[model samples]
Structures are given as C-alpha cells and as structure tokens.
Target: MKSKTLLILTGHTKGLGHAILDQFLSLESVQVVALSRSSLDLDLPNVTEFPLDLSDLNALEANLTKFFPKEESFDRYILINNAGWIGEVKQVGKLNPKGIQRVMNLNLLAPMILTDAFV
Candidate 1:
C-alpha cells in the first residue's frame, strides 16, 4: 500500500480551508477528512466528511476517542484548525449569553480539543 498523508481540516466549506482542500485534492497520496458543520456534498476520491458541531462540547468530546484510530499509521498527520467565530459585533452586555458561549466553544475550546487528540 502507498503511504498516505492524512489531513484533518475544519471549516473546509469556505475561505482558506476551501482553498486548501482544493489544492490537497490534486495529490493522490493525501487523504482528507473534512470536519464541518455544513454538508460538504463533495464527490471526490480520497475525501471523507465528518459532520460535527464544534460548539457542542458533549458531542465534540464523545467523538474524539474514535476520530483517528491509533491503529492507523500515516506518513504524515496534519490538522488544520480553521473553524472559528468572532461572535456578535455588539457590546458585551448587549450580546446574548449563548453567543458568547458559542464563540468560546468554537474558537477557543474546539481547537484545543482537536489539537490534544492530533498531537
């Protein structure tokens, strides 16, 4: 079997993540696992979509243990944490409590959780 490079990319539906995914697809040796809340609906070879809501800690934690099985060895493991939120553009007091939590969960907590598993 050919050695493969595993790329775990978040926010792959748009922006820099989208651009990166486009580039990675050209390489037959690169295996892409796209993590996004949105449906990727991509019919490309060597690509897998992992639909996840990063804002939900319960769901995020539950999925980590099996996200990348220890049995599988890759030539290289790459994790791109591109998912984030800037939150509402309002005063702190004016912002909804849920929005703050969403920002924290997606921006700060999710990347840490993913990195902890990746490395």
Candidate 2:
C-alpha cells in the first residue's frame, strides 16, 4: 500500500488557502486536516475540518495536541500557516490598540506558537 501524505492547513475556507487545499485534495494519497475559524464546505473523502479561533493563544496551545497526534502512518507531514489579519488602515499613532493587538496576535503570534509546537 502507498504511504499517505498528511497536510495540516489553516485558513483554507477562502482565497489562497482554499486554492492550495483544492489542488492538494486532488492528490489521491493526500489527507488534509484543516483549521479555520469557519469550517470548510467541502465534501472530499480525505478532508478533516477543525474550527478554531487563532487569536486565543491558550486555546490554540491546548488544541495543538489534538491536531498533531503522534502517529507514523503517513509518509509525509506538512503544515501550512495561511491565516492572517490586516489591521485597520491608519497611521501608527492613530491605530486602535485593540485592533493592533488582534492583528498581531493572529498574524504573528499564532503562527510562531504553532510552528514551535510543530517543530
């Protein structure tokens, strides 16, 4: 039997992430584990969806184990950190603290945390 390919993808419900997910799903040996704020409306046999809020650091850390189980069934494991947020367009001086915090948490902190866990 051919060894399976495991893909852990984030923000796959729209845009570039969705495009990548489509192409990967076409591969017969690939299985996708997708994490996003909203679940994807895909009907593929090999797709597993996890709805998550990346802005919550504690929740993300707690859930990492669930997404990344210690299993050697797959020949390859890939992680795609595709989720990002752009804060409101404004001068730095005029930026809202809460908005900036939200953007930074999602775009930078979450990816770093996830990468650390993955590595």
Candidate 3:
C-alpha cells in the first residue's frame, strides 16, 4: 500500500527534529522527508533525506521541486519547522546581529517560503 502523509522535518540530524523524525518513522502511514543542513545517519527505509541549509532559498526551492514533485504529491503535508536558535551569546544586546539574522532565516523565512511552495 502507498503512504499518503508526507512529513517534512528540519534539523533532522539532531535535537527535537531528530526525535520527531523518529516518531514519524514509527507511524506506518507517513513518508518521512527529513531535511537538515547535512545528511542524517538514520538510514531508515521509510525516510528520504533531503539535506539543505534552508537559509538558501534558491537552492531550497529547487531541491523541494526535485524532491516533492507534483506527480508524487502527498495527501497531507507536515512541516515541522523546528530549526531555530536560542541567542548566540545567551544574552540580549550581546547577541550577534549576523547570528540573529541566520537564526531568523532558518527558523522563520525558510518555513514561510516552503509553506508557500507546498500550497
């Protein structure tokens, strides 16, 4: 039988994202499309790894098109936007603007673009 649900996860190699990926894989009806800045070592049969920086919109869009082509459309798409930062220096003004921008790019902007594309 074919899987109808598609699970898109960020930071798939570690942390909350990895845990979510693990749970998703356990469910029989979902196809896990694990996204990360680098490739994950999970190597599960139901999981397809799409390593991406997410910060790069052009590359992300292109890769999304290639990976999630319309011909293989998912009935239900799950976007787990779990990639984020908790402040670089762990302080208010001490936070690096560049680092903040990187966080925003990965955490917020990438998801928004991918959401628009998914719809």
Q: Assess the local accuracy of residue 108 in candidate 2 as a C-alpha lDDT between 0 and 100.
A: 94
CA lDDT, every model vs. true structure = 0.87, 0.87, 0.76
lDDT of 2 by residue, 24-49 (tens): 98898988989899986777788888
Question: Which residue runs of candidate 3 sit more than 4 Å off their true CA positions?
Answer: 1-3, 90-95
Q: Which TM-score value belongs to model 2?
A: 0.89
* TM-score on alpha carbons, each prediction: 0.90, 0.89, 0.79
Task: Output the lDDT of residue 65, model 3.
Answer: 72
Overall local distance difference test of candidate 1: 0.87
What TM-score quantifies how close candidate 3 is to the native fold? 0.79
lDDT by residue (1-119, candidate 3, tens digit) is 56589777778788888778777878877877777888866667668888788877778877877556455656688877777665466668687888888777877888898788766
Comparison by TM-score, 2 against 3, better one: 2
Ranking by lDDT: 1, 2, 3
The lowest-lDDT stretch of 10 consecutive residues in candidate 1 is: 64-73
Regions of model 1 farther than 4 Å from truth? 69-71
